[model samples]
Target chain A: MIEIRNLTKRFGSLTAVDDVSFDVGRGEVLGFLGPNGAGKSTTMKMVTGFLAPDGGTIRIGGLDVASDPVEVKRWIGYLPEGAPLYGEMTVRAFLRFIAEIRGLRGAEARRRIDSAIEQVSLGTVLEMPIDTLSKGFKRRVGLAQAILHDPHILILDEPTDGLDPNQKHEVRTLIRGMSAEKVIVLSTHILEEVDAVCTRATIIANGRIVSDGTPEELLRRSRMHNALRLGLVVGDAGSAGVVETLKAVPGVALVEVDAQSGNALEVMLFPAGGVPLAGPAGEAARANGWEVTELHVERGRLDDVFRAITVGEGGASHG
Target chain B: MANVWIIYKRELSAYFGTPIAYVFLAIFVFLSGIFAFYIGNFFEREQADLQAFFQFHPWLYLFLIPALSMRLWAEERRAGTIELLFTLPVTMTEVVLGKFLAAWKFTAIALSLTFPFWITVNYLGDPDNGVILAGYLGSLLMAGAFLAIGSCISALTRNQVIAFVVSGVVCLGFVLSGFPLVLDFVGAVAPPIVVDTVRSFSFLTHFQAISKGVLDAGDVIYFVSLIVFWLFVNAVVIEWRKAG
Candidate 1:
């Protein structure tokens, strides 16, 4: 378990992390969602004991971080933002060095090194210098070092930042596989990543956390949650009439034309409060003799919730 | 201590993993020979001692040791590996001591390569082997002092060129502080005691005494304490940089 309270860090006059606090227990994967410079990396640095916080305290497994930093560090594995490694060392030599300092020795060291190599599929490039590897392999090498000791906590910063889609899937599967026992915390701007891997998502903006909950809870906060998209066989000249008719549905509070083509139209009907509008809207459409081509309720769009919460903050969406 | 040893092995191997170790060793041995034989006229002097070879070490180390120690921490910062290192389960003192000791040992290897000079003098004449041994010790201690200064400066910036140039200038200041040209200028503005205090801090004053076969406790203490002081500062500088 990792617990942080009232953490703060300041660079000159700018507050990089401002009284931030959160906790993660065993078997929980917390995804830090934010824009660039939203203090996610800063918070991770403080938790890993790389940077000291100006105020507040961090406790890992019941030991204070500032007082017993090395002990705390022994229980955690960290992959820094860029996954920096010694470029001159061969992959095998580099892993050996890390294993040695992590207090593994003899057969135990060899065993851990072999396991890490196998886990990351690094057997082929063991003799190659890290500087000569591609970006994907370099990242895997970084991951291999972090897991060599099998620490109880894993703090990975943007673990799949530059990976290809297949590699991303592999890494996500790896994280999910490891999430059953370790307290995993990873930060990313990718919304789909949170849904795929994280058990909980925390949205942060401007050095402050805006929301923290499960992916489903945050998705339900979207305005489009439970809203229905109705595709009607109405002519282009009747889009205005279609909107007026759907606006009179019992649970729908708003109706707008989403798309228009000759003799076909797509419109959205937003529910009032938390009610589901599909049943009432469907009955109204049948009574009006309208031909309904397509209709489905949205589970909610995370991107919309993410944008709504972090829009005015700096660099909200580069997409 | 175990942690220090682990770091030390990695750092020492890091030197050999590149062509740096071989290149540095070759240049160091070659340069010492050129300086001692051609410039110091070792053959022309026909001396029974290695005074000519021992004298140029301080000057040679002024440039060479800076080149050696410039990458100690600067390269780690530039490559962003310092974060990886600091986040590991090791203390600051262990890392600093480990890196310094590795560089010092590499210098020791280069110094030991010059044993042929000792062999040549022994084969040619009845040179006092005790004085030559003392010279080697003095040279090693002086090199340690220079390395400590360079290592501390290396921790101050990410640019190795800046670390090299600044360390060279600082070590030059230490070597020249005892000369009359500098003391005379100091004497013009300060009291005699102040000039004497300034003169006592020069690398020349301490190293010259030991090079002449006088293993004074004060000189040995000076070099050891200088190394200790600078390494402590190196740790402090790293912490400050991390915070900044």
Candidate 2:
């Protein structure tokens, strides 16, 4: 478990991380969402004991970070932003070096190193220097080192930032597979990653967390929740009865007429009390024998919610 | 201490993993030979005591030790590997000490390559071999003192060229402190006691004693304590400014 309270950091006059606090339990994957300069990397550095918090207390596995930093670091594995590695050493040597730093030696160290290499698919590049690897392979090597000692807590900053699409999927799968045992905290601006791998997400902006919840709950923050857009191609038919038919559907509180697209009638259906209009709207279209051509239900969009919360809409930032 | 050992192994191997170790050793060995024989007139002086060889070490180290120590912390800072190192389960002291010891050992290796000089001196004339050994020891200690100052200065900057120039300038002060040129300047205005104090602070005064085979405990303590003091400052500087 990771516990942080009132975590704050300042770089001269700029308050990078302002009074942030959160708790992470075992078997939880917390995705940190933020825009550029949102303090995600700073928070990770503090939790990993790289940077001391100006005002705060951090405890990893019940040991206070300030008092017992080495012990706290022992319980945590961190992949810093950019995965700063010694480019001179080969991949295998670097892993062995980290293993030694983590107090593993001999057979146990070799065994763990092999498994980590296999886990990240870095076996092929073990003999190659880290500087020679591609961006994707370098990221995997960083991941390999982070998971080498198998610490209880894993803090990764942008784990899949420079990887290709297939490599990103592989990393997502790797993260998901380990989600049941370790307390994983990863920072990224990718919205789909939150839905794909993160069980819970926290949105940070202007050095403060604006929202925290499951993906669905965050999506519900969008203005288009429970709104449905249905287009009909009744063959030269205008908005003769489509708007009325959609409005008459049960659980649909409002129906608005939209502009025609290529001789197709478009009508928007708004559900009552945040109920789903997909079922009722689809049923109405079939029952009225309307040649429905296109239909889309807007449960809400995560990106829209992210922009609204981060752009300081409604003054969401506390500082 | 085990953590320190791990970092030591990594940093030591890191030197050889690049072309830097060979290059530094080649240049250091080549220049020391030229300065000791050609510049210092060792061949014409016909002195078997190696005073000619030992006299130029402080000057030699003013340039060379800074080169060895410049990359000790500056490279890590430039490449951003300092973050990875700090995040490990080790303190700043361990990291500082480890890198220092690695650079010190590398310099020692380059210093030991001058054994042919010792062998040649022994073969040429009846020499005080014990005094010659003591001179080698003194030269190595002076190198450590120079390296410690260089390493501390290296921690203040990320650019290696800046690190090298600043460390060289700082180490030069220690090298010139005990010379008559500086002491005469001190003696002209200050009391004799102040002049002696300033002379006592010089690395040359203590190194000269050990190089002559006096082996006084005070001289040994000066070099060892200088190294310790500078390493402590190195740690503090890193801790205070690293997060920034």
Candidate 3:
């Protein structure tokens, strides 16, 4: 388990991470979602004991990061942003070095290194120099190094940033498999990636966490209005009255009459509470002498929720 | 200590894994040979001491030692591998000491290869082999001192080029502090006590005392303390940057 309390970092006059606090339980995959310049990487660095927090505490497995940094580091396996690696060393050599530093020795170290290589599917490039590999393969090499010691917490920054589609699938599967024993925290801006891999997400903006919850819960909390659009075939001069009558329904919020083509009119309905209005709107249209030809309910997508919670509407505050 | 040794093995192997070790060794051997044969007049006067060889080491190290130590931490920071190293279970002391030892040992390897020159001196004349051995020890100690300074300077910057330049200037100041040119210049402007204090801190002054076939306890203590002091500074710098 990891507990971060009021973690803050300041670089000169710039407050990069501002009094952010959260907890990550064991076996939970938490996605850190943010745009460019967010404090995701800085927060990871502090938790991994690479950077000291200016004004808070981070404990990994009950070891304080600042006071017991060595012990905390022993519990963390971090893959830094961009996967910084020693290009001069071969993949095997680099893994062995990391293993030695993590206190693995003899047969145990070798076994762990071999398994990590297999896990990252880097067995083929084990003997090759890391500088000679492509970007995707180099990332795999870095992943192998991070998992070589098999710590309880894994902090990966952009694990799938440079991977191809098939590679991304394999890495996602690997992460999901590892989530049974590891507290995995990964960062990405990809919405679908969070939906596919993360059980929970913390969205950060302007150096503060704006929202935190499961994917479905975030969608429910954003609570933007849902809409339905319908094309109708009605008698002449009756389409205006049909739109006005549909607007009077209990769940319907607004009704707009669209352009007419011959005898057909397009009518759009907005629901106040994001309810499924297609069926009710169709019924209301049918009762008003309008033959409903097309009706579709549009639910707010995760992208819409993200934008609403992060940017919000004009003059809207997100806290 | 075990963690220090682990880092030591990896860093030492890295030196050998590239052409750096070979190049440094070749240059050191060629320079030592030239100093022994031409400057010392090994065959003409048949000197019984290694003064000529040891005399030029401080000047030689003023350039070469910085080159060897410049990349020790600067490259790690530039390549972002310092994050990997800092996050490991090893402490800052271990990392600094391990890297210092690795660079010192590389210098030791180059010093050891000049043993063939020692053999030639022994073959040509009734040289004081004990004094020659002491000179080699003094050279190694002085190299460690230079390397410690270089390592500390290297930790201050991420650009290897800047590390090289800064470490070079710092090492040069130490090497030139005791020379007549610098001491006379300082004497003309400063008080006697100030000049004496600076002269006492010069690495070349202590190295020269040991290189003259006399192992002064004060010089030995000075070199050892110099190594420890600079390594402590290295640890502090790394810790400070980590906090930043």
Candidate 4:
């Protein structure tokens, strides 16, 4: 378990992390979400004992971080942002160095090294220098070292930041596989990763956490939650009637007409009082004998919610 | 102790893992030989003693030792590996001592490689072997002192070039403190006691005494304490500025 309270950090006049606090218990994978400079990496640095919090208390397991940093570090494995490594060393030598520093020796060291290598599937690049590897392999090597000691807490910063889609899936699977026993905290701007791996997601913006909850709960905060997208093979003139009829449906509070593409009209129907509108809206459309082409319920988009909560509208970001 | 040994092994191997160790060793041997044989006129002096070789070590180390120590912490910071290291379970003391020892041992290897001078002197004349051994010890101690200063300076910055240049300037000040140029300037304004104090801190004062076969306790203590003091500062600097 990792406990942080009132954690704050400042770089000169700017407050990087302002009174941030959170906890991650065993078997919980917490996905840290934020914009480019939203203190995700700073918070991870403090938790891993790499940077001291200006005003806060951090506890790992039961020990205080400030008072017992070395002991706390022994229980935590951190992969810093950019996955900085000794570029000159071969993959095997680098892993061996980390194992020894973690106090593993002889056969125990070899066993852990072997397992970590196998877990990351780095057998082929054992003799290859880290600097010579591709960005994907370098990231895997960083992951391998972090998991070599099998620490109880894993703090990874943007673990899959620059990887191909397939590599991203493999890394997510690896993180999910380890989520059953360890308290994992990884930061990324990728919204799908929150749904793919995280048990809980925290969104931070402007050095403060704007929202924190499970992926499903966060989606509910979206403006389009439980809404319906109705596609019709109708002209712009016909879309007016479609909008009027959709607004008159029982649960739909409002209907928005979107731009026409080809000969089809797109309209979004919002629910009233958190009620489900898909069943009623579909039945209403069927009774009218409308040229209905497409209709589906919106589970709420993380991208929309992320934009709404961070920097507001008209502000473009990675999400 | 175990952690120190582990870090030491890695740091030492790291030196050999790149062209750094070989290049440093080659340049160090080649430069020292050129200085002793050509400049010091070892053949012209007709002296079997390695006095000609050992005298130039303090000057040779001024540039070479800083080059070796410049990367001690500066490179770690530039590559962002310092974050990885500090996040590990090792204490700052273990890391400082380990890196210092590794550089010291590497310097020792370079110094011992000049044993052909010892062999040539022994084969040529009846030079006092004991004095030559003392010179070697003093030279090694002086090199350690220089390296410790460089290490501390390296921790203060992320730029290796700045570390190297600043360390070279600082080490030069220490090496020149006992010379007439420094003493004359100090003696003109300061009292004899102040002048003596300044000379006492000079590397030359203690090193020259030990090089002349006089293993005074004070000189040995000076070098050892200098190493310890600088290393302590190195650790403190790392702790204070690592987060920045």
Candidate 5:
């Protein structure tokens, strides 16, 4: 588990991370959602003790990072941004160096290194110098180094940055497999990655935590949450006529025309949260004797919420 | 100690991992030979001593040591591996000491590869091996001082070129401090005590005594203390840079 309180860091006059606070517990994959220059990497660096914070305290497993950096480092497996590696070293040699740095030696070191190599599927490139490998392979090699010692926490910055979709899936699966034992914190601008692996998500903007909650909870906060959408097969009279019929239904706060194609009317009805809008709208459409086409309820999407929070909308829905 | 050795082994092996080590050795061997036989006229003098070989060490190290030391911290900073290195469970002092010693030992290995010079001296005449050993010890210690200064300077900038040039200039000053050209300039305005103190700081001043087999404790202490002092400064600079 990791705890950060009012973690403030500034570079010159620019505040890289300002008054950010968050805690990640065991069995949680906390996704740091932010755009570029959002201080995501800076926060990760401070947590890993690579960069000392200008203010605030970070506690890992009850140990203060400033006071006991080496011990705290022993408990962290960090994959820094860009996955910087010793390009001159062969994969096995490079990993052996990390194993030694992590205080493992001999058979145990070999076992862990082999296990890590196998875990990240880096066995094929074990004999090659890291720089000779492709970017994806290099990222995996960096991943292997982070997980080699099996630390209590894993901080991976842009874990799937340059990977193909399949590689991304594999890395997400790997993080999921390790999620049970370690407190995993991975930062990225990829929204789907959060939905795929994060147990809790924190959305950061302008060096501040704008939103923090479970993935589903965040989706529920989206503007599209619970809005009923109806696609009607327009009659002689177009869907402009059915918009009024749907608006007349109870719990329907407002009805607006959505994008229309030939002969079909797409309308979204905003609900006042009093009744089930989808059921009532479907019944009302049947009563109106108009040919109805698509009828569905929106469960909401994270991209909509992300765009909302990042764009400084402050969760302003169609209320 | 274990941390130091771990980093030391890594840093030392890293040098050998590239072609730079071999290139450096080949250049050093070729040049030490040239500077001794051709430049210093070792054959014409034929004094049966390695005076010429040891005489050019300070000059050889002027550019060569900076070449070796330029990448000590600058390359790491440029490649962003400094983040990975700092995140490791090692102190800045340990990293500095480990890297400095690695370069020191590397220069020692380069110095020792001139065993042919020692062997040639032994084969050609009755030479004082003790003086040769003293020369080697002095050269390595002086190399350490140069590496420490280079390491400290390398931490100041992310540009290896700057690191190389600045460190080369500093090492050149350390060597030239005892030269009359430099002494005369300072001797113009300064008193005798100040000028002598400046002269005392030159690598050649202490190296000459050690090369002649005097092995004066003050000269030995000067090189050792210079190495230690610069390494300590190197650590402080790294820490200060990290703070920024």
Candidate 6:
């Protein structure tokens, strides 16, 4: 388990991370979502003991990151934003070096190195110098080094930034596979990735976490009102009264004509449950002698919730 | 100590894994050979000691040692690998000592390659083997002192070029402080005691004393203290940077 309390980082006048606190339970996969300069990377650096925080404390498995950094480091594996590596060393050699530093020796060290290489699928490039590998391969090599010690906590910053679709799937699968035994925290700007992998997410904006919850829960909470959009073809001029009648329905909060064309009216329906009153909306429209051209329920997605929480705007759809 | 050895082995392998070590060794041996045979007139002078060969080492190391040691920490910082190293379980002291020892050992290998000259001197003239051994020991100690200074300078910057130039200039000051021209210039302005004190702190003065077949405790202490002082400075710099 990882517990962060009142964590803050200041660089001169800019607070990179501002009093952010969160708990990551064992066997949990948490996604850190943020836009550019949102302090996700800064928080990860502080947790991994690479950057010192100006305030608060980060505890990994009950070990204080500041007071017992070595012990905390021994329990965690970190991959920084750019996947820094020694370009001169071969893939196998670099993994061996990391293993040696992690206090692995003899047959055990070799076993770990081999297992990491296999896990990251780096066997084909094992003999190549790191500088000669492609960006995706380099990322895999970095991942291999991070997990060489079988650490209990994994902190990865943008782990799939450079990977192709297939490699991304492989890495996600690997992460999900390991999530059952360790606490995995990854930060990315990809919303689909969060929906695909994260059990819960903490959305950060301007150096502070604005929202934190499970993916489904975040979407549900951020859905302030149920609304549906419908496009209708009116046989005559009677459709105008249908909008007023739909507004009089039990759960209907508001109704507005979205657009108009020749013999067609597109209307937006707002309901109190934030669940679309489309069922009642369709019946009311038919009763008023209007032909329903398009009727569908609108469910808020994770992207809508992310934009609403981070940008303070709810109308923007990521699709 | 085990951690130190772990770091040491990795560092040593890193040196050999690249072309840098081989190129440095080739240049070092080539220069030493030229100085010993051609410049020192090994066969013609028929010296009973390795004084002529050992005399040029301090000057040679002034440039060579910095080139070898300047990349110790500067490259690590520039490449962002310093983050990987610091987050490991090892302490700062072990990292410094391990890198220093690896560079020192590489210098030793280069110095030992001149054993053919030792054989040549023995075959041509009966030189004192004890003096020859002491000369090699003194040379290694001098190289360690130079490397320590370079290591500290390397820790200050991420640009290896700047680290090399700055360490080279600082080392040049130590080499020239004991010269008569520098001492004479100092004598014209300061008290004689002050001038002597400045000269006493020079590496050349102590290195010269030991290379002359005399194992003086003061000179030994000077070299040892020089290495320790600079290494301690390196540790302090790292700590300050980490805190900041």
What TM-score does each prediction get for chain A alone? 0.93, 0.92, 0.83, 0.94, 0.92, 0.83
Index of the highest-DockQ prediction? 4
Best by TM-score: 4
Candidate 6 lDDT, tens digit per residue, A103-221?
99999999999999999899999899999999999999989988999999999999999999999999999999999989999999888888789999899887788888887677676
In candidate 6, the residue pairs with backbone N, CA or C atoms under 3 Å apart (3 or more residues apart, or in different chains) clash, namely A225-A274, A226-A274, A226-A275
* Model 1 lDDT per residue over A90-113, tens place: 999999999999999999999999
Candidate 3 regions exceeding 4 Å error are: A221-270, A278-299, A312-319
Residue-level lDDT of model 6, residues B1-77, one tens digit each, is 78788778778878898998999999888887778668877567767778878888877898899999889988888
* Tens digits of lDDT, candidate 2, B1-244: 9888889899999999999899989988888889889998888998887888888889889898998899898888888889989988898878888888888889889989988888888888888988988888888888988999999998998999999999998888887889999999999999999999989989899998998987888998999999999999999888887854
Worst 10 residues of 4 chain B by lDDT: B47-56
lDDT of 4 at B1: 84
DockQ for each of the predicted structures, in order? 0.80, 0.84, 0.65, 0.86, 0.71, 0.58
Over B111-197, each residue of candidate 3 has an lDDT whose tens digit, in order, gives: 999888787777777888888888999999999999999999999888889999999999999988998899999999999998998
| Lowest summed lDDT window (length 10), candidate 1 chain A | A310-319
**Could you list the CA RMSD of all candidates, in the order they appear?**
2.4, 2.2, 3.5, 2.4, 2.8, 4.0
Q: Write the per-residue lDDT of candidate 1 for residues B1-244, one digit (tens) a residue.
A: 8999989889999999999899999999999999999999998999889988998999999999999999999999998899999889999999999999999999999999999999988888989999999999999999999999999999999999999999999999999998789999999999999998888899998899888889899999999999999999999999988744
**Minimal lDDT window, size 10, model 2 chain B:** B235-244
Worst 10 residues of 3 chain A by lDDT: A310-319
Say which docking band candidate 2 falls in: high
lDDT of 6 at A283: 81
lDDT measured at residue A54 in model 4 versus the true structure, 0 to 100: 93
> Which residue pairs show collisions in model 3?
none
True contacts kept of each: 0.86, 0.88, 0.78, 0.90, 0.75, 0.69
- The digit string of per-residue lDDT tens for model 5 on B124-224 reads 89999998899888888888989999999998888999999999999999999988899999999999999999999999899999998889999989999
DockQ of 1: 0.80
Off by over 4 Å in 2: A229-231, A239-260, A265-270, A287-289, A313-319
Model 2: per-residue Cα lDDT at residue B97:
85
